[model samples]
Target: MMNKTNKILIQWLSWPIHVRIALIVILLILFFGELISVIEPKEFPTAFDGIWWAIVTVSTVGFGDSTPKTHAGKLVGMVTILIGASFAASYFAILSAATFQKQQAYVDGEIPFKRKNHVVIIGWNEKAHEMIQSLRAVKPFKQIVLIDHSLKEAPLMENVHFIRGNPTNDFTLLKANVKEADAAIITADQHKNELDADMQSVLVLLALKGINPSLYCVIEILTEHQANNAKRAGADEIIKTYQLTSHFIMSSYLAKNGLSTIYSKLNPATGNSFQVLPVPENLVGKTFKEASIHLLDQESILLGIKREEEAKMNPPLSYEILAGDYLIVFSH
Candidate 1:
């Protein structure tokens, strides 16, 4: 039984730092009492008497259960009291520090995008790279940040920053600055089950709304039901990827035209290929004809106009440009 007790004491000593520190302090008081008894037998006549005295003094119980009789013994008891107080204070300090670190990490994870100036990406996946490429083509100079955990690289672009954590984490949402983003594009990560992707997209939308009530949020969904859910999550726009892909594919098949052109333009090998240019707010009063002339001069073709709530593909030359219109231009 004595050996067993020794083994248990050793095991406790080997525990984590905080645990060991606490144990060491308790043992220190015990050892001090025992040593005093051995050197000055009058201080503690027996092991039971020494332990009883320690318990009463350290606990401030002062039960009068046992009392140190020698001057040396009383001094040892005083030292034990100080040690116990110090250990209690240190324990609380360590616990408070740990708690603060957890709270700080949560704050860092919230979406950081703000200012109606940065690109806000919601979901993360293999396709995220391609989506980012598209955004780059449209707004090469804009700041782009990604919000997702699965991505080891949230913002792969040189000017981009990554949230580097889960989208649902509130801190992750604030870190992305969801409120100040120029536009938020939520895409589903590539997954075998389309439903899972849709759910993630919806979750991102919900997180964004909680952070910024007025922030523009776009979500991608695989099904109609998912789309409805995304809308309920406060998404301003929800794109049904499969449905749109089917439409595009069917149209391409009927026309006997391959999607290669569409693919290459959106996924250009050259960095200088297809691009999206936001019309200068100052140029909003200009007619589309003027914008077309400017684009042609730059050796680019104007494909369409993207406004606050409307995307007009292949708008007429006479169409009037607005302050926030994003002109879709294709260049070499």
Candidate 2:
């Protein structure tokens, strides 16, 4: 008994086979007519007239205005017409299929973005949603594409495109437009074994980098050791999930009551209530007092300034803000 999947596969394969056959037949008849015409000059009135005679004969649209004189030429023209008719039929079928595919993709919302810049999120996990929310918060305008093995349901958010397949699969990534994506964030594949997560992440990063060397990628890892391995695997950033959660829990305990509120609010929840705004390099020479106007103008509070591998939270009002400072800002 043939499985349903096998039936569907056969149906899909048939279309491509038909198209290929049509292409081959079209080329064969076209070349055969050209060769026969070249060999029989006296039989054709002129080159253009001969080509016209060939087209009409091969197409089975004999108008009788131009006919092959020699018996051999007439016999060849008859055979060529059958071949050309088959070729024309095949060409029409292929053309119709190509048009149908475009229309179907549009109807199904599978159209590619014209801008060609997007962030691709590979694999699915609880953390994947969090990362998406974080990215949406930080970069609201950024285009995001999600790829997963089982996308049974549509994403909760609007404009987040989905391509259902294995992230490590080259075809899947290509469908997600990974080559043109500005960045790719790969979360740990929860359905697979933990040991395999790092390997899969490496494969995905290698695939993307192989396509576009400058493409940036961030991989989520379960351990610090895996983080190091991922970095070596060409990850621009390796987020250690365990360490981050540990820090959060510890900080939450220390804060306890209202202090915990500060920690919770400060942590990137959804793209909604909190965000970090990197201070512009142009403002680096000035102090907080100088750049405070811009922050105030934006109606966002500067929680602190992160500069040169250090964070000075609630820096003194007089603190000097240097270049490369990132402002931890909170928006109500």
Candidate 3:
């Protein structure tokens, strides 16, 4: 019996500190309540009354409705006040500390993400920041997880969960719950040179695909040559940053305000932006011109058709739409 009792006590002591403190607080109240009721039955008529008095006295909310008349009961009350108050204070203090520690861990990016189907963005840069902001503007409630090893703390943004670790590491990807994520974006590391950045991005893409082959990955490659490597690594879409930037710069040079015009059209706040949608069943077997006319009535402009892995912008008017093709449109 003694061994069993000792084992039980040891098991209870091994429990979490907050749980132990809470249990101790409740036991203190019950033990003192029963003792005072037995010592002064006239003052505390029942165990319930003694418990009510104990609660009131322990909380220091002394109501003069109940008082101990005998010296023994008064001494019990004093002991209750001393021991009960200490346990109560300790419980609250531990609770507050635990809350603060959890919050601090989150800010420090030490907490792992537990939610599923979130968009995970790898690397921290101006492009990543803008992408996050743009995503928030488009879908206010969408969950986003940002992974980067360079950051000391998570960025302050709504619906953005940050994981501080190398994107190439499987452990880091798991920390962001990448296996359950809907999609992932691998941004080229700005700190490295063009070739090195593209290599790093491809490595991260490979890691992501290794963990979740179904994860739709969009990777940015600084060099055009690395785009094929990114595609070979299971990237669904590869953004050639240098080529696009050069084209945009050239366009701006040839036509004043070209860059600003493009930015304005792409801005979510403008309510006129690009959207990729599955080809409607009705649109299948129709020509590009017919699809354009059909979409025009709905205030959307058909810009391109994404068939399988290729996106042909402004295809010939007589081009026929297929069943599995996706339509790229500029919507207002």
Put down candidate 3 lDDT per residue, 283-308, tens digits, no spaces. 99999999999999999999999999
Measured with C-alpha atoms, the lDDT of residue 98 in candidate 3 is 98
Which scores higher on lDDT, 1 or 3? 3
lDDT of 3 at 204: 96
Give a tens-digit lDDT track for model 2, residues 178-295.
7788898888878777667767777887887877778888888876666777887788877887888898788778777665556445535443364556778777777776667777
TM per candidate: 0.48, 0.55, 0.92
Tens digit per residue, CA lDDT, model 1, 1-332: 99999999888767865676667667866776676667557757776666666656666667775566677767777787788657746766776886786555434443344544788776666566777877676668778787766654334356666676777777766667666777778887775378887877787778778888888877778878888888778888778888988987887888786764765554554544645677876568887888888778878888889887677997787899987779888887
- Model 3 clash count equals 0
- Model 2: residues >4 Å from true position, as ranges? 1-115, 130-143, 152-157, 193-195, 258-294, 309-319
lDDT for 245 (candidate 3): 83
Q: How would you order the candidates by lDDT, starting with the best? A: 3, 2, 1
Where is model 1 more than 4 Å wrong at Cα?
1-116, 153-156, 266-332
After superposing candidate 3, which stretches have Cα over 4 Å from the reference? 1-10, 257-259, 322-324
